[model samples]
Target: MQQNAPFELLSQLRSEAIALAAQGLTYSTQSAGTKNIAYVVNGVNFYCEATDVKEVSVCENLMIVPQTKAWMRGLVNSKGVLYSVTDLSLFAGYGRAIQAKKGHLLLLAEEAVQSSILVNRVIGFRYFNESDEMSSLDDKQEALDGLSAFVDKGYRADGQDWYRLNVSKLLASEQFREVQ
Candidate 1:
């Protein structure tokens, strides 16, 4: 079902999935029912709501990104001004959803200067059915704070279902705040 990867990759992924499933999955809600985005990496599936995403682009040489207290991935030249990039996958606690290759950057607008998140391969966009029920994070909500919600059903690339990603909590995490 995959191509050109070591056997250990899948094995490790299996363990990783189990670990992830044991913990709480984060998500949010949207109008017209609920929506989420499916991002694929090394044959693995990662889901997030479409609203969480900002601008998508190919990876380019970043300019003067200060390598200080910030979780600055690098200083990328977006349009003209140097845009400080945030590596969300790192914060999400998973292998890169998208490698920092020639073409991959998801710029999300956070108040003013957009926040950049690196994904593996952004499969595409997806929406949820109204019939889907919500599942609040409860204790998990404390860590996520006022931004994240909970979801029971979301679309996976392989036609299976999963929980949506919580973009609000993600942006609010220590990993994001460090971006300067």
Candidate 2:
């Protein structure tokens, strides 16, 4: 029994190391422009920095607030956190996004200003490569009017123009903070 003690300890340690590695979540740190999540709102496809997005889920039990802007969809309790929901399309001057039978919500990172924006559909995850040619909307003359200031940049991939949605800028904008 004494002779087997060292071997037993080694086996137990190896098993624990394997289990811990399996349970740990690893994130990629490649030079590619940052992992992004693609989503659509009001037929406009946009991608958001994955780090700035906290969670995405189907919105439920949303309580409407009266006498507020049409873009404001009210508040919702998601996983014990109350989030102020907004219609991204309408706020961006792209017309209202009609909620489907099952509406989708993308919760922003918990910053000083945090809220969930309604999205039409999630296009899954994609890497925005750093080498991809990017251009500012102002230079490209593709201004989105009210939303131009919130767009970080634009790039083309898969024959489609994908805009980087800047949540920080949007949250800091006066239009967003005036939710009274």
Candidate 3:
């Protein structure tokens, strides 16, 4: 045996363990640039992969977690589990002057909390393998709160351009606060 063969064997074992763990993780199929992922709530699109999402199931109704306060738009039952729903269109600025309605609900169990983002209806899912996104949102619109990071730019809708959404922040914003 070689002089350092024992250490090499140990290193090989560690590499195998890492590979095994990685194999356990799964990533979704990336969509073509600007291919179109129907809006769950107007401009707000759901973007998730194995890295942050495992599986997505349709919810009949998610129970409202009142503690979430204004951000909470009642709740829906997701696979027997309750998820707090947020009027995503209203939460994403798409509802600027429009009113939110009862439509489809997106159950996001990514991190921190499992939130329900209410959308009009899930048209479909999109994938982006290689794409161009904006550097960042303009500082002038800092108060926009639910601003996107310009990920996957050039997405057009009705001759208009759009960007990807930030799921986490949308769930944490004060957009739900009413004029009390």
Candidate 4:
């Protein structure tokens, strides 16, 4: 046996544990660059910072609240916690999301405000570097003109334009505050 072998093993184990914790906080399908969770709402692809996401699951048994805005999908109980779910597609001026047999919800990270965003599907995690960001939207994509205010940046990958949404800004918006 080598001297100080036990101490060295413990040190290695500690380092590995820390790395694992960080990976949990920063989710990604790719190994390099900033991490994001890709999701689709009404055929539009969007990415949210991985750190801002708490969970993604198929939401069922939604309890619709009367006299609320059209975009409000109502309350859903997940893991004994009640979350106010919003139809992001309708909120963004798009038509209502297709209410199928099942629906997906992206839960926001625990913070001052708690809510879930109704999405068509969770498209898995994505990775993008600073260099991957595009300077502006394409000429034909005029409908996305106002989206710049809610996004951190825009990127093109896998033949699709992905907008990195700023969740914090979305949460802080007056429109969001008036959801009640």
Indicate which candidate wins on lDDT. 4
Residue range 1-180, candidate 3, lDDT tens digits: 898999999898778767877989433335434443444445444443323332344545444454554535676655566666666555545544223344665566564666655567666666444433434446424333344442323243344334555555444555533412
Give the least accurate 10-residue stretch of model 2, judged by summed lDDT. 25-34
Tens digits of per-residue lDDT, candidate 2, 1-180, equal 699999999898778777777989433344345788899866667888888889988878889999888888888887787889988877877766548335688889966656988888888787765556475466644445567778878777777777888988888789987766
Positional deviation of 146 in candidate 1, in angstroms?
18
| Per-residue lDDT of model 1, residues 28-58, tens digit only | 3343444556665334345676666666677
Error of 2 at 50 (Å): 0.7
Q: lDDT of each structure?
A: 0.55, 0.77, 0.50, 0.78
Per-candidate TM equals 0.54, 0.76, 0.49, 0.76
Model 4: which residue pairs collide?
none
Alpha-carbon deviation at 113 in model 3, angstroms = 0.9
Residue 108 of model 1 has an lDDT of 65
Better of 1 and 2 by TM-score: 2
Clashes of 4: 0
**Model 4 TM:** 0.76
Rank by lDDT (best first): 4, 2, 1, 3
- Pairs in steric clash, model 1: 58-103, 58-104, 59-104, 63-75, 97-119, 97-120, 98-119, 98-120
